[model samples]
Target: MPTRRRFIKCLIALGAGLLPWSGWSEMLKIVNHQAAQAAILTNDSSAKTLDLIHPKDVSYLYHTAADDISALTASDFQGRRAGTVGEEKAAAYLIEQMKGLGLEPLGDLINKNTRNYSNAFTVYPVIEEFYNGRLTFRPGNSQDLRTPCANVIGGIMGKNKSESVILSAHFDHLGIFQGHLYPGANDNASGVGCILDLVRQLVQEGVKPKCNIVLAFWSAEEMGFVGSFSFLQNPTFSLGGLKAVFNVDTIGNGALNDFSVWASSDNEAVQAIQSAASEHNISIPLASHEGYNSDQVYFNLDHLPAVTLMARDWLNKNHTPDDVPDFVNPEKVALANKILYKAVKKIAY
Candidate 1:
């Protein structure tokens, strides 16, 4: 591992290739570090905060995912189904990104170079098809097909390692169906994008958490949360050691600047997130309800702290070919990224 100074310098060395303007290079420096050691919340319930994290930092923390979504949802991805060529491409890209960002390997994995950064498993996909708004699983015979899948994991170590906050998003989506490709840009590509961008910031900005922050890109989620559930069953770290789980899914659409964090009303993570969202003035709403569609369901079922931020118009072109990149709002995607980052900081910092 590089020294903290070298890691910070790596941010600068990432260089001008991705910057919209080369002159903005100076702006990317860590000019403000007040938020680094803040308590993350105030004594007063209404006064939570993450100080001096400028607005453009959201773009810096978010654009990569947007750019990644474009790549991940492109023709190369073929909708990113588990055990397929498209899914393998997506996993390779995630491993490459994790390596580039200098995150530590959490545990063992099928690929030695990837370490725990890539966990491959044999998952039974729960294929669903909808007709006239009625959803049904594919036939019994089809259910017998078990395929090898991969999940990408990485994290930032904090001062306290006994417990950690998890930031997750599934990278898998429905592959081609009935001869039409399902782009799955908003269904999940957007969520994975957010995870990538946040981890990138934690890596480059030298912002260490008080508790470790674990980032996971689940596989085979489209197959009924198999990836997340599998990890929960056999995680490198203990499930009991988890402080909270923040999941992002389908965050690329519905009201250009608005999003919703879905969770049960009694869940404490919701209130903490509400306070954090208020402090940051992020354009996000908390929708208190149990959601069975996304990966948060398993955590919620186990009575663990879990919440997911997703686009309100998640049904728009969802699981279909129309969930393409040109339709996503970069600004809105950036806002969701900001809210998730802030929420994670509130919990771990």
Candidate 2:
């Protein structure tokens, strides 16, 4: 049997068109249904029986999430900082994954091009200065600096194309600060992995949502939610019909079984998340508060009902060099994926 790393590499190569589908037949067999069933039955006694979707399906998705985290945290991506070559590489990788999953590009809808998966934007980051013990932000000029970044957007159309639900996570981290690498595995890569696996599970199960499901991999979130704000300013879809935005971030750390949720308001979206948790037998301690940071902040500022799911004890390694894949727990990431999957399904389906 091929190792998981080799299997993931083959999948990436296949998605990038470097390998033909016929050539990957043998490698694809590594994920055979029988193997998945055996793995689940042996590993998780509770999953010996089936549920809404096959337990084996969940196992496959879980492995995919782990693979995604590994890929994102790899050194080749250079911490995936916005405007850097590493970030570009990460975006290309994500585009290939989206294409492989049969998701349509939701970026650059006007231009039917190969690079349409990227929603390009420029960020003239504001310069902050402390004046008289008060922090102030000034408009960046040419003397300052400007960074070119893009958000990778993909989606699956639903029965009602007019309405949409967004499942988003930021893909950018603090590049390399002072000669140290911040892998950002738990800070956000975990969230991105969970969303990718959620999409994979939805596609594999042939689930047709009631509203369009947009998978947004935001960029430059560390620079104050720039990518999401850019999307709002120039949206490719109708914002009026947006049902809700479910954001996941920093779920790979802290207690494995403990989860926290912050919503813009106590709306149907929150209720949907709570109901999903209940149905899925996951415990989510709901905490409603204002000014919770993450990619969801922009949407909340626009009066959109959005909810963010995260775990505790993330601040210690958030932007440090210690934030690496070694510290991320696959089970915690898998749990986050399951909760988001059910919650999004409750709303979109």
Candidate 3:
């Protein structure tokens, strides 16, 4: 039986030393290629031993204070408009926080002069002008509710180009529907809070990566991953150089009392991620549902390794007005973040 400590040690040995990005990339290719061949030869038995460890032991407590903050942003807060007033404000706030945490805003610098607090993809311009400034399911109804939205982007550059990791989540929620303010507590505010805390952790440790860490707070994801899709088209860094992306969306209220990770089928990075989770006794249920639905869709299409993380199997509250705070389990959310942090460090560093 492979113990957790030995598992981590194996990963560390895979890198040997984390100083060069090319070396790490090369190592990843070799290990993943071997794993792939092994899978083909053996009939996918790798999962047999991997899934035995229980996921409950590694779960972390959801911080009450963090939950409160997420509640205010996703559910309790006012409107967020994409490329407009409210969303711009939210984007600015996120950038300020990132700057305060010692991370340089890489997206803006990459985009150059047009760089504002927020990063704009071309789709937002069309949505704001043609769609009449609302993220809607209805095509031609005035009664369609409007969502406040914004896309916040920031990054800490890695040691070099070949190795990069993206940490992303959507912060925008349904603004107003049927004269009631929709508090999207679990719908996505939880994801935003988790990303923010992850940023803080990276800053606190001052642990720079061998590849860059890009943090994005997408806007209008509910409106079809508009913000993220746009960013993907005009990414700050080349998509080919991207190592992996972790997309956290709607990470609240799971009926199963646990969460799962959905990894794209073409990605080889999933093995390393699974190995990392196994070290912590966390179970990541894998899937390959591709609809370009979330921010991860762009990354997936770009042929990069990517995965979406969220509390699994939540019913009913997906896009309704009832998706408010109190129902969310912050303990579950924090546990997800811890797993995310470990997965990120293992892959990026």
Candidate 4:
């Protein structure tokens, strides 16, 4: 595979042709290029192997959750807005984490020599306005308003590769608006952190699932679910083979022991989640909704079985500068991690 620097340079070159904002594109190209090079030089050489001893205790879980959230909410990521340098940097970070976990790359497999974990896609301008905090899509195509984005994907292959289960979290948030940063800690960093720790525990314990377990970190979710919509339109794997999709979002900053789950329908996926919560002694309140929010929307629209887990006050710090890591509850995040881990295991194993 090409070095990270070379890969980003290629992406920047390709993006220049598609984007009309020459000044913005040029600035990002320079920033991303330098950042990618710096990352390569300082990259850790040690692989995250099972041989490395770790105390799999409650404290460790809290530490891991805090670490992941802090990293994502760091100022260097600049809010991780879609189609921006910050989002690209976050994607690069996820790629490294997935690599460390020994996951198989399931995106950009066309070029064997440069296979990567990025499923690059374009987000066309469609929304006319945000009426009552809800987006209304425009009818006609506006090619000039297209934005570039990508989804980070990795997976653990199981004995039955023909079937798969997906655990997803969107890493994108509203970028700096009006000169203030919306750090997106509880909005989504919590979800990403929870999934990362969950997978880490699974790998460390050597649990071999029956169906492939895909870890998908979606981009452009704040942009009306464009990344996931694109994935559904042109998936890297066979969508028909997907047994279930469990999406985690905003699982921090709420009541310490309170959580909510909404499903596409009353199906096996929902049953699996309920069973996992019951077995693991986790409290997850099951509820019913239209499933129009979060990354699960596209899958639900396709009539595919999906569910979303949430544990945050939507009107509190969401999309605001106050949404910083300080507000995130590590205990709550760890609880979410445990719930998702057990739920996915029940379905995949």
Each prediction's Cα RMSD? Answer: 7.8, 9.5, 13.7, 14.2
Give all TM-scores, in the order shown.
0.79, 0.76, 0.69, 0.76
Q: Model 4: per-residue lDDT, tens digit, 1-349?
A: 2576576667677667666775444445344434433443453442222122122232232236577788888888998888889889999988877877778888877675555799999776544444455323333376567778899998877778889999999998876765777789987998998888887666554545788889999998887788889889888988788898989988887777677777656666666777777776765666654534788888988988888888735446666678888888888887777777778877887
Q: Model 1: clashing residue pairs?
A: none
Please give the lDDT score for candidate 1.
Answer: 0.71
How far is 61's C-alpha from truth in model 4 (Å)?
11
Off by over 4 Å in 4: 1-63, 112-114, 125-141, 280-292
For candidate 4, what is the TM-score?
0.76
Quick one: ranking by TM-score, best first? 1, 2, 4, 3
Task: Please count the clashing residue pairs in each candidate, in the order shown.
Answer: 0, 0, 8, 0
lDDT of each: 0.71, 0.75, 0.61, 0.75
Candidate 3: deviation at residue 14, Å? 42
C-alpha-based local distance difference test score of model 3: 0.61
Candidate 2 structure, TM-score to reference: 0.76
Q: How many backbone clashes does candidate 2 have?
A: 0
Give me the runs in candidate 1 sitting further than 4 Å from their true place.
Answer: 1-63, 107-114, 125-128, 133-145, 280-292
Q: Which tens-of-lDDT digit does each residue in 61-108 have in candidate 3?
A: 112326434534552256453434545555666666666655655564
Q: How many angstroms is residue 260 displaced in model 2 relative to the true structure, after the best TM-score fit? A: 1.3
Candidate 3 C-alpha RMSD relative to the actual structure = 13.7
